[model samples]
Target chain A: MARVVVDVMLKPEILDPQGQAVANALPRLGVTDVSSVRIGRRIEIDFTGEADLDRAREIADKLLANPVIEDYEVRLVEGAEVA
Target chain B: MARVVVDVMLKPEILDPQGQAVANALPRLGVTDVSSVRIGRRIEIDFTGEADLDRAREIADKLLANPVIEDYEVRLVEGAEVA
Candidate 1:
Protein backbone atom coordinates (compact mmCIF):
# COMPACT_ATOMS: atom_id res chain seq x y z
CA MET A 1 0.00 0.00 0.00
CA ALA A 2 1.14 3.52 -0.76
CA ARG A 3 0.48 6.43 1.59
CA VAL A 4 -0.10 10.11 1.02
CA VAL A 5 0.05 12.64 3.85
CA VAL A 6 -1.86 15.88 3.87
CA ASP A 7 -1.20 18.66 6.33
CA VAL A 8 -3.96 21.23 6.61
CA MET A 9 -3.13 24.44 8.41
CA LEU A 10 -5.10 27.59 8.98
CA LYS A 11 -4.20 30.54 6.76
CA PRO A 12 -1.61 32.90 8.19
CA GLU A 13 -4.14 35.69 8.37
CA ILE A 14 -6.63 33.57 10.28
CA LEU A 15 -6.89 33.73 14.07
CA ASP A 16 -6.34 30.46 15.91
CA PRO A 17 -7.93 30.77 19.33
CA GLN A 18 -7.34 27.12 20.17
CA GLY A 19 -3.64 27.52 19.78
CA GLN A 20 -3.76 30.74 21.75
CA ALA A 21 -5.40 28.91 24.64
CA VAL A 22 -2.55 26.45 24.78
CA ALA A 23 -0.03 29.27 24.70
CA ASN A 24 -1.81 31.00 27.50
CA ALA A 25 -1.70 27.94 29.73
CA LEU A 26 1.99 27.33 29.12
CA PRO A 27 3.07 29.86 31.72
CA ARG A 28 1.64 27.64 34.43
CA LEU A 29 3.72 24.78 33.08
CA GLY A 30 6.72 27.01 33.68
CA VAL A 31 7.43 27.02 29.95
CA THR A 32 8.32 30.61 29.24
CA ASP A 33 10.19 30.32 25.94
CA VAL A 34 7.31 29.33 23.71
CA SER A 35 6.14 32.33 21.72
CA SER A 36 3.21 31.00 19.75
CA VAL A 37 1.18 27.93 18.99
CA ARG A 38 -0.85 26.99 15.89
CA ILE A 39 -3.03 23.91 15.61
CA GLY A 40 -4.08 22.17 12.38
CA ARG A 41 -4.97 18.80 10.86
CA ARG A 42 -2.92 15.96 9.42
CA ILE A 43 -4.55 13.39 7.22
CA GLU A 44 -3.19 10.11 5.94
CA ILE A 45 -4.66 8.58 2.81
CA ASP A 46 -3.68 5.06 1.93
CA PHE A 47 -4.08 3.85 -1.62
CA THR A 48 -4.46 0.23 -2.56
CA GLY A 49 -2.41 0.88 -5.65
CA GLU A 50 0.31 3.42 -6.30
CA ALA A 51 0.41 6.69 -4.40
CA ASP A 52 -1.31 9.29 -6.53
CA LEU A 53 -0.35 12.84 -5.70
CA ASP A 54 -2.98 14.31 -8.00
CA ARG A 55 -5.78 12.28 -6.46
CA ALA A 56 -4.56 13.05 -2.96
CA ARG A 57 -4.38 16.71 -3.81
CA GLU A 58 -7.90 16.61 -5.15
CA ILE A 59 -9.12 14.93 -1.98
CA ALA A 60 -7.32 17.48 0.14
CA ASP A 61 -8.73 20.37 -1.85
CA LYS A 62 -12.28 19.06 -2.05
CA LEU A 63 -12.79 17.23 1.23
CA LEU A 64 -9.96 17.76 3.68
CA ALA A 65 -9.35 21.47 3.69
CA ASN A 66 -11.37 24.65 3.53
CA PRO A 67 -9.74 26.82 0.89
CA VAL A 68 -11.09 30.03 2.35
CA ILE A 69 -9.50 29.57 5.77
CA GLU A 70 -6.93 26.80 5.36
CA ASP A 71 -3.92 25.79 3.30
CA TYR A 72 -2.92 22.20 2.68
CA GLU A 73 0.21 20.41 1.57
CA VAL A 74 0.18 16.96 0.01
CA ARG A 75 3.12 14.60 -0.27
CA LEU A 76 3.88 10.90 -0.52
CA VAL A 77 5.32 9.21 2.56
CA GLU A 78 7.71 6.34 1.98
CA GLY A 79 7.91 3.63 4.65
CA ALA A 80 5.64 5.53 6.97
CA GLU A 81 5.09 3.56 10.18
CA VAL A 82 1.70 5.06 11.07
CA ALA A 83 -1.41 3.01 10.47
CA MET B 1 12.93 31.70 16.42
CA ALA B 2 12.79 27.94 16.58
CA ARG B 3 9.76 25.80 15.75
CA VAL B 4 8.57 22.47 17.07
CA VAL B 5 5.94 20.28 15.42
CA VAL B 6 3.69 17.93 17.32
CA ASP B 7 1.58 15.45 15.38
CA VAL B 8 -1.23 13.87 17.40
CA MET B 9 -2.93 10.82 15.98
CA LEU B 10 -5.54 8.37 17.16
CA LYS B 11 -4.19 5.02 18.21
CA PRO B 12 -4.36 2.49 15.43
CA GLU B 13 -7.03 0.47 17.22
CA ILE B 14 -9.29 3.45 17.85
CA LEU B 15 -12.30 4.11 15.65
CA ASP B 16 -11.94 7.15 13.41
CA PRO B 17 -15.38 8.12 12.24
CA GLN B 18 -14.23 11.37 10.69
CA GLY B 19 -11.72 9.64 8.48
CA GLN B 20 -14.26 7.01 7.56
CA ALA B 21 -16.70 9.70 6.47
CA VAL B 22 -14.12 11.18 4.14
CA ALA B 23 -13.22 7.78 2.76
CA ASN B 24 -16.89 7.03 2.13
CA ALA B 25 -17.22 10.23 0.11
CA LEU B 26 -14.18 9.56 -2.07
CA PRO B 27 -16.14 7.28 -4.42
CA ARG B 28 -18.27 10.26 -5.41
CA LEU B 29 -15.04 12.07 -6.27
CA GLY B 30 -14.28 9.25 -8.76
CA VAL B 31 -11.49 7.86 -6.61
CA THR B 32 -11.66 4.21 -5.61
CA ASP B 33 -8.11 3.00 -5.05
CA VAL B 34 -7.98 4.28 -1.49
CA SER B 35 -7.75 1.66 1.22
CA SER B 36 -8.06 3.81 4.31
CA VAL B 37 -8.09 7.37 5.63
CA ARG B 38 -6.95 8.61 9.04
CA ILE B 39 -7.23 12.11 10.42
CA GLY B 40 -5.37 13.77 13.31
CA ARG B 41 -4.04 17.02 14.67
CA ARG B 42 -0.84 18.91 13.83
CA ILE B 43 0.39 21.52 16.23
CA GLU B 44 3.24 23.98 15.74
CA ILE B 45 4.92 25.61 18.70
CA ASP B 46 7.30 28.49 18.23
CA PHE B 47 10.04 29.18 20.74
CA THR B 48 11.52 32.60 21.20
CA GLY B 49 14.91 31.07 21.91
CA GLU B 50 16.32 27.65 20.97
CA ALA B 51 14.23 24.62 20.02
CA ASP B 52 13.40 22.47 23.04
CA LEU B 53 12.37 18.98 22.14
CA ASP B 54 11.90 17.92 25.74
CA ARG B 55 9.69 20.88 26.55
CA ALA B 56 7.68 20.35 23.38
CA ARG B 57 7.25 16.68 24.21
CA GLU B 58 6.16 17.56 27.72
CA ILE B 59 3.64 20.03 26.40
CA ALA B 60 2.32 17.49 23.95
CA ASP B 61 2.05 14.84 26.62
CA LYS B 62 0.45 16.99 29.25
CA LEU B 63 -1.76 19.35 27.28
CA LEU B 64 -1.97 18.37 23.63
CA ALA B 65 -2.68 14.67 23.59
CA ASN B 66 -4.96 12.50 25.64
CA PRO B 67 -2.67 9.62 26.50
CA VAL B 68 -5.57 7.21 26.55
CA ILE B 69 -6.68 7.64 22.96
CA GLU B 70 -3.99 9.57 21.13
CA ASP B 71 -0.29 9.26 20.35
CA TYR B 72 1.85 12.31 19.79
CA GLU B 73 5.23 12.85 18.22
CA VAL B 74 7.30 15.94 18.86
CA ARG B 75 10.23 17.15 16.79
CA LEU B 76 12.11 20.29 15.94
CA VAL B 77 11.37 21.79 12.54
CA GLU B 78 14.10 23.74 10.85
CA GLY B 79 13.19 26.24 8.15
CA ALA B 80 9.52 25.27 8.08
CA GLU B 81 7.34 27.41 5.80
CA VAL B 82 4.00 27.04 7.58
CA ALA B 83 2.73 29.89 9.71
Candidate 2:
Protein backbone atom coordinates (compact mmCIF):
# COMPACT_ATOMS: atom_id res chain seq x y z
CA MET A 1 0.00 0.00 0.00
CA ALA A 2 1.14 3.52 -0.81
CA ARG A 3 0.22 6.53 1.25
CA VAL A 4 -1.06 9.58 -0.61
CA VAL A 5 -1.37 13.06 0.81
CA VAL A 6 -3.88 15.53 -0.62
CA ASP A 7 -4.00 19.22 0.13
CA VAL A 8 -7.03 21.32 -0.84
CA MET A 9 -7.11 25.08 -0.60
CA LEU A 10 -8.86 28.12 -2.01
CA LYS A 11 -7.34 29.92 -4.93
CA PRO A 12 -5.25 32.94 -4.10
CA GLU A 13 -7.51 35.27 -6.04
CA ILE A 14 -10.56 34.20 -4.03
CA LEU A 15 -11.44 35.54 -0.62
CA ASP A 16 -11.59 32.84 2.05
CA PRO A 17 -14.30 33.51 4.62
CA GLN A 18 -13.70 30.21 6.36
CA GLY A 19 -10.06 31.05 6.86
CA GLN A 20 -10.98 34.45 8.19
CA ALA A 21 -13.34 32.84 10.68
CA VAL A 22 -10.61 30.56 11.96
CA ALA A 23 -8.18 33.42 12.27
CA ASN A 24 -10.71 35.35 14.26
CA ALA A 25 -11.31 32.36 16.53
CA LEU A 26 -7.62 31.84 17.32
CA PRO A 27 -7.31 34.52 19.97
CA ARG A 28 -10.39 33.13 21.71
CA LEU A 29 -8.68 29.77 21.78
CA GLY A 30 -5.85 31.42 23.71
CA VAL A 31 -3.53 31.28 20.72
CA THR A 32 -2.11 34.75 20.66
CA ASP A 33 0.64 36.52 18.78
CA VAL A 34 -0.71 35.15 15.53
CA SER A 35 -0.45 37.85 12.93
CA SER A 36 -2.57 36.10 10.33
CA VAL A 37 -4.14 32.78 9.48
CA ARG A 38 -5.67 30.89 6.54
CA ILE A 39 -7.39 27.53 6.62
CA GLY A 40 -7.65 24.65 4.15
CA ARG A 41 -8.08 20.86 4.13
CA ARG A 42 -5.69 17.93 3.96
CA ILE A 43 -6.53 14.32 3.25
CA GLU A 44 -4.42 11.19 3.50
CA ILE A 45 -5.36 7.92 1.90
CA ASP A 46 -3.86 4.46 1.90
CA PHE A 47 -4.29 3.03 -1.56
CA THR A 48 -5.20 -0.58 -1.83
CA GLY A 49 -2.97 -2.93 -3.82
CA GLU A 50 -4.84 -2.27 -7.05
CA ALA A 51 -4.61 1.52 -6.95
CA ASP A 52 -1.56 3.24 -8.42
CA LEU A 53 -0.24 6.75 -8.03
CA ASP A 54 -1.92 8.00 -11.20
CA ARG A 55 -5.20 6.54 -10.08
CA ALA A 56 -4.89 8.28 -6.77
CA ARG A 57 -4.33 11.59 -8.50
CA GLU A 58 -7.37 11.00 -10.63
CA ILE A 59 -9.44 10.38 -7.52
CA ALA A 60 -8.20 13.61 -5.99
CA ASP A 61 -8.87 15.72 -9.05
CA LYS A 62 -12.22 14.25 -9.90
CA LEU A 63 -13.97 13.85 -6.57
CA LEU A 64 -11.72 15.01 -3.76
CA ALA A 65 -11.46 18.65 -4.77
CA ASN A 66 -13.11 21.44 -6.74
CA PRO A 67 -10.68 22.57 -9.38
CA VAL A 68 -12.37 25.91 -10.14
CA ILE A 69 -12.19 27.42 -6.67
CA GLU A 70 -9.56 25.22 -5.06
CA ASP A 71 -6.17 23.69 -5.83
CA TYR A 72 -4.90 20.32 -4.76
CA GLU A 73 -1.74 18.23 -4.85
CA VAL A 74 -1.01 14.59 -4.21
CA ARG A 75 2.21 13.25 -2.80
CA LEU A 76 3.10 9.59 -2.62
CA VAL A 77 4.93 8.43 0.47
CA GLU A 78 6.25 5.00 1.26
CA GLY A 79 3.98 3.04 3.57
CA ALA A 80 4.80 0.56 6.31
CA GLU A 81 5.88 -2.92 5.57
CA VAL A 82 3.31 -5.68 5.76
CA ALA A 83 4.11 -8.35 8.28
CA MET B 1 5.17 38.51 -2.68
CA ALA B 2 5.53 34.72 -2.79
CA ARG B 3 2.54 32.45 -2.41
CA VAL B 4 2.97 29.62 0.02
CA VAL B 5 0.51 26.79 0.48
CA VAL B 6 0.49 24.81 3.70
CA ASP B 7 -1.17 21.49 4.16
CA VAL B 8 -1.75 20.17 7.69
CA MET B 9 -2.98 16.68 8.42
CA LEU B 10 -3.17 14.15 11.22
CA LYS B 11 -0.36 11.64 11.39
CA PRO B 12 -1.30 8.49 9.51
CA GLU B 13 -1.22 6.26 12.58
CA ILE B 14 -3.45 8.52 14.62
CA LEU B 15 -7.21 8.19 14.59
CA ASP B 16 -8.77 11.36 13.17
CA PRO B 17 -12.10 12.15 14.72
CA GLN B 18 -12.64 15.27 12.63
CA GLY B 19 -11.96 13.41 9.44
CA GLN B 20 -14.30 10.66 10.48
CA ALA B 21 -17.08 13.14 11.22
CA VAL B 22 -16.66 14.86 7.87
CA ALA B 23 -16.67 11.52 6.09
CA ASN B 24 -19.84 10.52 7.87
CA ALA B 25 -21.46 13.80 6.94
CA LEU B 26 -20.62 13.51 3.24
CA PRO B 27 -23.57 11.38 2.30
CA ARG B 28 -25.91 13.78 4.00
CA LEU B 29 -24.39 16.54 1.92
CA GLY B 30 -25.61 14.53 -1.08
CA VAL B 31 -22.08 13.43 -1.92
CA THR B 32 -22.13 9.70 -2.29
CA ASP B 33 -19.94 6.86 -3.57
CA VAL B 34 -17.15 7.93 -1.27
CA SER B 35 -15.60 4.92 0.38
CA SER B 36 -13.65 7.00 2.89
CA VAL B 37 -12.60 10.51 3.75
CA ARG B 38 -9.87 12.12 5.81
CA ILE B 39 -10.16 15.77 6.69
CA GLY B 40 -7.27 18.16 7.24
CA ARG B 41 -6.30 21.83 6.92
CA ARG B 42 -4.81 23.89 4.12
CA ILE B 43 -3.41 27.38 4.52
CA GLU B 44 -2.25 29.80 1.85
CA ILE B 45 -0.31 32.94 2.59
CA ASP B 46 1.02 35.79 0.53
CA PHE B 47 4.39 36.51 2.06
CA THR B 48 5.15 40.19 2.34
CA GLY B 49 8.37 41.50 0.90
CA GLU B 50 10.19 40.92 4.17
CA ALA B 51 9.23 37.26 4.53
CA ASP B 52 11.15 34.72 2.49
CA LEU B 53 10.15 31.17 1.68
CA ASP B 54 12.23 29.83 4.52
CA ARG B 55 10.60 32.26 6.94
CA ALA B 56 7.14 31.22 5.80
CA ARG B 57 8.09 27.60 6.36
CA GLU B 58 9.30 28.43 9.82
CA ILE B 59 5.96 30.04 10.61
CA ALA B 60 4.12 27.01 9.34
CA ASP B 61 6.15 24.56 11.41
CA LYS B 62 6.25 26.63 14.57
CA LEU B 63 2.82 28.27 14.75
CA LEU B 64 0.50 27.11 12.01
CA ALA B 65 0.61 23.45 12.89
CA ASN B 66 0.70 21.15 15.90
CA PRO B 67 3.92 19.29 15.28
CA VAL B 68 3.24 16.35 17.58
CA ILE B 69 -0.06 15.07 16.18
CA GLU B 70 -0.04 16.68 12.75
CA ASP B 71 2.25 16.84 9.72
CA TYR B 72 2.45 19.67 7.21
CA GLU B 73 3.98 20.54 3.87
CA VAL B 74 4.79 23.91 2.35
CA ARG B 75 4.73 24.60 -1.36
CA LEU B 76 5.99 27.81 -2.90
CA VAL B 77 4.06 28.90 -5.93
CA GLU B 78 4.84 31.96 -8.01
CA GLY B 79 2.65 34.95 -7.30
CA ALA B 80 1.17 37.48 -9.69
CA GLU B 81 2.90 40.65 -10.82
CA VAL B 82 3.10 43.40 -8.24
CA ALA B 83 2.01 46.08 -10.67
Top of the candidates by TM-score? 1
What tens digits encode model 1's per-residue C-alpha lDDT throughout B1-83? Answer: 88999999999999999999999999999999999999999999999988899999999988999999999999888886634
Q: Can you give the lDDT of residue B73 in candidate 2?
A: 78
What are the per-residue Cα lDDT tens digits for candidate 1 across A1-83?
89999999999889999999999999999999998999999999999988999999999999999999999999999997644
| lDDT for predicted candidate 2 compared with the true structure | 0.65
Q: Give residue A25's error in model 1 in angstroms.
A: 0.5
lDDT of 2 at A17: 82
RMSD of each: 1.3, 6.3
lDDT of 1 at B7: 96
Which residue pairs overlap in candidate 2's backbone?
A: A40-B41, A40-B42, A41-B42, A42-B40
What is the iRMS for every candidate structure? Answer: 0.4, 5.3
The first chain of model 2 has a TM-score of: 0.75
Where in model 1 is the C-alpha error above 4 Å? B81-83
lDDT of each: 0.94, 0.65
**Which 10 consecutive residues of model 1 chain A have the lowest summed lDDT?**
A74-83
- Predicted structure with the largest lDDT when compared to the true one: 1
**Candidate 2 lDDT by residue in tens digits, A1-83:** 54566777777687888667655665555544444456777776554453356655666676678899988878765653422
